[model samples]
Structure formats: C-alpha cells, structure tokens
Target: MIAIDNKLISDSVLEAQFVCDLNKCKGGCCEDGDAGAPLEIEELNELISNYEVIKPYLTPEGIKAIEKQGKYIYDTEFGWVTPTVNSGICAYGIRDEKGIIKCGIEQAYYDGKLKWKKPISCHLFPIRIQKSQQDEDLEYVNYEPRQDLCKAACKLGKQLKVPVYIFLKEAIIRKYGEEFYEALAASAEVVKK
Candidate 1:
C-alpha cells in the first residue's frame, strides 16, 4: 500500500463517488490514454513471456522504448523517475458488430479466469498515488473536479446517482477492499462537516 497524505486521501475518497457512474458511461476511463501506469513485476513477466500476444498491437518503436527504458528513469522533465509506457488499448477492448466497446479484462474476471485485476495507476485515477516530495511518502492527490468532465460524463453521472461520498468510497473499496471503505467513509464523513 502506498503511503498517502491523510487529508488528500480523505478528500478524494469523498469526491470519487461523483466520478464513477458506469451505467451512463461506457468505461470511457478505460478507453482514454494510457494513464502511465507502471507495469507490475508479474505483468512485466507476462509481457516478456507472452510478448507475441501484445506485440501485434504495439509499434516496434513502442516495444523498443519499453525494452530500453526498462521502467526506470534516468532523466526527464519530471527528473529521475520510473517511466510508464502507455500500453495503449486494453487487450479485451473490442468493438462488437454494433461497434460497442467491451472490456476483455472485466469479461475474464466475470468468467473466473482472472481474479482481482485492475491496472494500478488506472485504479488510482483522479487520486494520484506517487512518491512524496522527499520520496518518503506516497501522496494521494485529490481530483481537481474538472467542470469539463462533469459536462462530458454527466449523463452517466446522473444515472449512477453518484453522491460524492458514495462514489469515492466505492472507488477506494473497489481497489483496496472493505477495510479501506470503512476508513474512507469515516474520513469523508468527518471531513464533510
């Protein structure tokens, strides 16, 4: 678990309720840009072993970039850091005959072939989980609550009836579990007043 700012975590856990409305949205979050999630050790191994499976979708340059960077960073605008290659599309991202996008990962989860899967950085969206200023702590930056996002996702947001607290709690619980849910709920409730 990453160590995060208590205050930011509290606020984000509150706001997340407003952001997740699956019914009205077609998982646009999943379809969006590679949110720069770091590959886990297991995931990296999977790629190396089954490189053939995903290689077809990646440009040779992209593959070379990942291979050369090796996930560690030497220098960039952000200074030394672990590079997160935009893995591009989800393997299960498919368009039905009707052109509906579907998640292969969620489908696999439902089918019991995969358990407890979500890209780490993707799961921590709007709530940044990164090293602190001194790299001694993990900071959970709260979502800025973009007005544009509200306009874009409003239809589903309304349908999901995403009360801020509920949405945030659900997000946390989805990633962390019941214990996190209870803690976030407690934090959010106290922060509200």
Candidate 2:
C-alpha cells in the first residue's frame, strides 16, 4: 500500500478516519460508467499538462467513446454506445484469470509512469463530486448503490465515512491544481440528500 501525506483543507480530520473497502467495491466505478459532472476545460487541461505520460494511455478511442456518447465522462442515463469491451468492465480494468479485477492505471502508477494516474475521484473510491455550486464551490455526493456496499452494510448515499479527504486532496492537487483540488474538497463536504 502506498502512503500519501497531506492536510485536509477542512475539518480537524486525521488518518484514523479513512477506510478503503477495496474488497467490497470490485471496481464498481469503472464498470458502471457515468457522466460525472464534467470538469472545466482548465482543470482537464491541467491534468494533461502536468501528467503527459498518461496522456497516451488515455487513448483517442476513449475520447471518441466519450464523443460518441456525446460527453467527456460516461453517464448512467445515456448509457454507453460501445458496451464495455470486457463485459461492461471499464476499459482500463480487467479481471485476471483468478477473477480479481486489477486497475490498469494503478498498475501503471506503480510501474513508474506516475503520469498514468487518474483524477482524485477515480483514484478515491466510493466518493464522488456530484455537483458544483455557483460560489466556485463544489458539492460532493455519493452514488446510489444497488445494494449495501460497505462491510458495515451501510445504506447507499450515506456518507462514505472513509476519511479520504487527505488522500483525495493530494490526488486532485497533483493531477489538477490546488485551486481545483480545493474546490473538490469543498464539494466533497455536501451532506447526502
């Protein structure tokens, strides 16, 4: 496991609060495509500029897939035109013969091409930025699960309680910028509706 250190922009949170339900998630985000609230062009550009190595891995095919779908990010309501090649599995993910799904980007990151990493939301599971507010602030929200997802069997849309703010903050700032990262942190704070 990789250890990343950073202070959360809000709250007096600490490392003790975060929990990654890796076993339970089963790569749900990649398999279940959704048009996340799109990022601004500047933010997207920052990711590309600061992390150019992964740019190649981000195949034009993926962009075309998004374009064909009429959006940059996949969404549930619109559905994918090209069904996930691996039986609805995300393009960069694959389940090994042992039936364990491994994340390609994460693998690449460990392989030394750190540029092949994902945005914070992609890297930080179970937590997503659902909406952006007008004050340049954003609202983060959890996705509605088909069933209970946590080991605690917590209901969907309930706060993830994973204490991932610091991890996410580092990821967002590294890929995007402190500004975009700050907005995302604020967004992540929205109470679940």
| lDDT of the candidates, in the order given | 0.47, 0.44
Off by over 4 Å in 2: 1-18, 33-83, 136-147, 152-162, 166-193
What are the per-residue Cα lDDT tens digits for candidate 2 across 1-193?
1112222233322222444444566545566654342343444553445434543444454444433443234345532222243235544455655554665446667778775454455554444434434534444334332244433323211255545545345655665578766655455455221
Evaluate model 2: give its lDDT: 0.44
How much is the lDDT of residue 52 in candidate 2?
A: 42
After superposition, the stretches of candidate 1 with alpha carbons farther than 4 Å from their true spots are 1-7, 10-12, 15-25, 34-88, 97-100, 124-126, 144-161, 168-171
Clashing pairs in 2: 18-162, 34-74, 34-75, 35-74, 35-75, 138-187, 140-187
